[model samples]
Target: MGFPSLYGGLTCLDFANTVDGRALPEPEEHLHDYADLVRWAAYADLLDTETAHHLALLAKARPQAAAASYTAALRLREATFRLCAAPPAANDLALIQQGYAEAMSTATLTPAGTHYTWTLAGDHLDRAWWPAAVSAVELLTTDRLARVKVCASSGGCDGLFLDISKNGSRRWCDMGTCGVEAKISRQTARRRAARRTTP
Candidate 1:
């Protein structure tokens, strides 16, 4: 299947949300293999199409290395999710720290419109998650971290997202799915209660 819709607002949060219903008994995993990681990286705009295709080919040639990189990426994704959605552990912080350090070691500050941004040098296998590591660190250190929220959907969606709403009242990850499902559930319950009372 294709990757889930990007509703996390930030790349790091979006990365964390690759697994749906994280708190549920059986979570849905989107990234199945190295190709999935490459596809997701491209979809997330972490890598251009050309770079993504190169990585996919490289992964095919070096299956072991690609599997290792995919494992590390999943570790980073889980660490990021815990850090953002709950009180993080020391190991989570350490993993994120290592990821951020690795990313920065290869990053160079490049001029943007009015400021500079760190750009990764080459299209390494691990490059897929480098920007997400940097983003996670930047987000954790900022006040906007307070805006981070877990989806409030009762259907057990544990997706993480940045709630940039003005009033901070944002609840569901996506209004179309979780929000609509919740509304229908509540309505059905109300109707059931009304029928019980009438009879």
Candidate 2:
């Protein structure tokens, strides 16, 4: 019900993981509504508390607009997942391009200690997903894109993450959850095989 752990190591990838069990028949959806989207933006540090509150109130006031924004967010999230974890599709890339353009149109170049960063301005409903769009574009354009990976748990997690391991051997999204489950499953399989052979 609550947002999945931020194991993706990137805000955009985490946003993609807002759905659990992407490989399952029916994945679990965490962002059920516009308010949930705002809360997720806040959780992902994409929005300040005040800005999140403002957006939540704005969503309530403009329900139809908020619904449209939510639909766009979901579109961006799926496009990000495909672009990061599979062979890039032209349509997916186009969606990301449109999202990035829209996000950048409203972004301001703000000073951040030593350098400037593109900060989304205003409390528009799309504020919840603008940073995600920007982040997806940034990651896709960088060499770090090589580090993006999909979960390898045999239980079929299908979560996306940036594998920052020294040898790039990380296979699971979380060592404590998917990793453990896979390890246990393998051990059980081995034990069963051993039993069958012994008999």
Candidate 3:
């Protein structure tokens, strides 16, 4: 989906990568490729989607639920950057920014009491998704207030949080574990499977 949707996806994990805590290098400090952070952020969005659904339902009843909706979306963006900040190429950044903004543009705040409950009332859904545009500012900002993940220009490999150690000197998700296993598995699996199918 779009980045606004993608950003919401990251909130699922609440930005907690390690079950435990030690000195860890920041995600923005490494992982220069958008693929790394974007993928992880997208993974996080899967979790956020559920939370957003429940929250949206609650907002239907609760008067102050607008804040919750906004907060949840805000968190999604934060966590995505926390784990996978990368500097996208100019074209990629523009694409992501525009798409997310466009998606959010149709969002509307159904007046509740004091603060309006957000809803898709404009056009994001009519053609594709207009009603869900409440999440647009969640992707961008509201009343001029916005917070988003700024892609970095340099960093280490993907999932580096899992790679850093007790001393926190490591980079990459795992040089000894996932990094090597992936290579070995790819090399062995193809050869073995190819032989089994060979004449």
The digit string of per-residue lDDT tens for model 1 on 1-199 reads 7788999999999999999888789999999988898889888888988888888888888899999999999999989998888767779988888999998999889999999988885567888788889889999899989999999998889888899999999999999988899899999999999999995
lDDT of 1: 0.89
lDDT values of the candidates?
A: 0.89, 0.90, 0.35
Best of the candidates, lDDT: 2
RMSD to the true structure for each prediction, in A, is 1.5, 1.5, 15.4
lDDT per residue as tens, model 2, 67-175: 9999999989989998887666679988988989988888889999999987887667898898889989899899989999999987778999999999999999999
TM agreement with the true structure for every prediction: 0.93, 0.94, 0.27
How close to the true structure is residue 106 of candidate 2, measured as C-alpha lDDT? Answer: 87
Whole-model alpha-carbon lDDT for candidate 2: 0.90
Query: Per-residue lDDT for 79-161 in model 3, tens only?
Result: 33343344434443343354356545654668898888644322111211112222332433332112222211122223313
Model 2 TM-score on a 0 to 1 scale: 0.94
